[model samples]
Target: MADLRPQAMIFVTEYIRNGNNATQAAIAAGYSERTASSQGSRLLKSVEVQQFLNKTEQNLNKDLRVMFADHAVNAFNVLLEVMNDPEAQHKDKLVAARDLLDRAGYKPTDKVVADVNTEGTIQIVFSDKMKKADSS
Candidate 1:
């Protein structure tokens, strides 16, 4: 990665931290209010800055996946307990079972209905230009 200037680094950090609001990030990085928007746009257009943002996003996604996986077993166990408990209310058990099935890729398909009503004449016109070209 290219060595970013202090202000550029701050802009990148603030851009991510502030929900990808470039203008706000530039302002937070001490850019002039009048130029913050353009400065942010320029920084984001830089190859080095883009690479940094992509890498940061990838790392954050990986970390979140790991965190979720770590607790997946506990979540499944709780759901199973609720689903299998005979004392549980029918509604509660059904909801738990549905959740488990949905997560397991056994969700029911949704039904869709479409209504169409048209009261207009349909017109089709052949262009003389096409015929003229074909004749040539």
Candidate 2:
């Protein structure tokens, strides 16, 4: 389970279960459409957000009777087929590859952690995006 607020849990689950559409998920989470894409991208980078997504995906797979090792293997096999098919759309192949990588425990990004003491003060640091921006 993610240590996120209730609204965030809703956003995370909706984002994953709804074709990975962040904008729609943000809207469903009550964010303004004008800022939804950026908000969704930010949420996607949160450790708690990714954790919730992975947890929910696992739960959903289990509920769908696809949690068995054999089933997972079969699913991967299908993804491979999609990825290798010459006639497959580029987008379909990319999606299949992404799904395969995700199911096989490949994370394309590192996590950023923030530690706050029991005091009432807060210390925040930007790591991922800021680092890239600075390098650029």
Candidate 3:
């Protein structure tokens, strides 16, 4: 079987959340504008679908969510700092960030640079910001 597409998976999850009208959701899900009703019916009738839907519904937050909006600006600043290095490449950004993070008492993992767009601009997705493990 082929690997599941992320968009399709997300669409399914969204559909499970608000699926009173199956045909309407199918068109919105990009699966098929015409076969939404049948597809939604088939999925709704499946045991696997029932379990998946129940689990997802249990995890869903219907209310407005809390966010660290203060952290958002700081995050953008950090990105700017990473992008300002003379090299501005993955390896260089990682090294630069590692030094700064270490000095600030945060021990984040060494950055792994990935070029997602094939445009040569490296992206460093930091895995963690671990506090000093133990000094005492």
Candidate 4:
């Protein structure tokens, strides 16, 4: 990515922090309110800006995955505690057990319902090649 001006960098940071509100990000980054919307749109169209945003997003996702993994063990332990505690409310225990089972990939099967409104006859035909192969 090309070097970005300080204001542009601020705009990018604010853009993400503000949930992709370009106009708000621009104003927060010191662009005039009158031109912030247009400036934000133009910046978003820049190749360098787009690259920076994508890289930032990828990094954020990586960080989030790491964070989730770090907490997963503790979360599972909490669920187990709740499930095993005799003093825990039955409903709460059931909920925790369900959550643990879900996280462990033992979720209940989903049933699909289909309504058929057409009737059709079924027929089977054998080709000459099939008949010859069968005889052989």
Candidate 5:
């Protein structure tokens, strides 16, 4: 993942990190603007380029552990505040509650099974909730 690349490729990597846009990165790396989209798409699919970007992101995430921890805690705290605040908007509170439930491993599809008859053919099942959340 750390294999060395040409200077233009290096420049393109930095551009991609900054904007997360391959076409813009290609243009910023001095490629022809007219062909930037196609060139960028091609460059993004290159093994070396992918490795460089993936390694860079992995390294950055490794270095940002403490920052990520703080953000996670702050975000959860905000969610809890929203969930508990009666003055908060109903939609906001519902979102917070849903998030908390999700984090707690509660899902609409959580199931319970029981046998209502001596025969194996009869089964009873109950879902955590009848309503399934829209994944999208």
Candidate 6:
């Protein structure tokens, strides 16, 4: 099966729930006007829809619009490579995210890189100022 991200699925879910046009979702998930509607239809009917809708919707923030614009533009910037090879998409997304963060002046490295167990769940540790009571 294809690797569909929850963020993409939420775009589909909101489109369906709102009974809106594919233009919105198309714009959201990095697709073109010529193919947005068809792509939305495909995502709407995807089996992964149920597993992701609620969580993705909850996680989407105001910055999503800006981030999405970056994703689409970045994706199209590498369209030639994407058409000739599938592996390039991941690189495209990573570059897109890095570019988005850079443009917004958000540096990921400054933040703590929480370690995750073999299961891939991140384990976050808090700093002293982030807590309440004084130390004994």
**Top lDDT model:** 4
User: Lowest lDDT 10-mer window, candidate 4?
Assistant: 109-118
Writing each residue's lDDT as its tens digit, candidate 1 over 8-31 gives: 888888999999999999999999
| Model 2 poorest 10 in a row by lDDT | 107-116
Model 1 whole-model lDDT (C-alpha atoms)? 0.87
- Local distance difference test, per candidate? 0.87, 0.83, 0.60, 0.89, 0.75, 0.63
* Runs in model 2 lying further than 4 Å from the true structure: 66-136
* Model 4 pairs whose backbones collide: none
Q: How many backbone clashes does candidate 1 have?
A: 0
> With candidate 5 superimposed using the best TM-score fit, by how many Å does residue 6's alpha carbon deviate from the native?
6.1
lDDT of 2 by residue, 28-116 (tens): 99889999999899999989888888888888888777447668788888999999999999889988998888877895565454556
Cα lDDT of model 5 by residue, 60-97, tens digit: 78879978887989989999999999899978997899
Candidate 3 vs candidate 6: which has greater lDDT?
6
Between candidates 1 and 2, name the one with more favorable TM-score: 1
Instruction: Sort the predicted structures by lDDT, highest score first.
Output: 4, 1, 2, 5, 6, 3
Better of 2 and 6 by lDDT: 2
Lowest summed lDDT across 10 adjacent residues in model 3 is found at 127-136
Model 6, 1-136: lDDT tens digits are 2476756765766575665665677667677778878877777676775445545565665468778988887665565454456556666655666665666688764334367688989888655654433354
Return the clash pairs for model 5, or none: none
Q: For each candidate, C-alpha RMSD in Å?
A: 14.2, 22.0, 17.2, 11.8, 11.0, 19.5
The lowest-lDDT stretch of 10 consecutive residues in candidate 6 is 127-136
**C-alpha RMSD in Å of predicted model 3 compared with the true structure:** 17.2
Model 4 misses residue 18 by how many Å? 0.9
Q: Tell me the TM-score of model 6.
A: 0.30
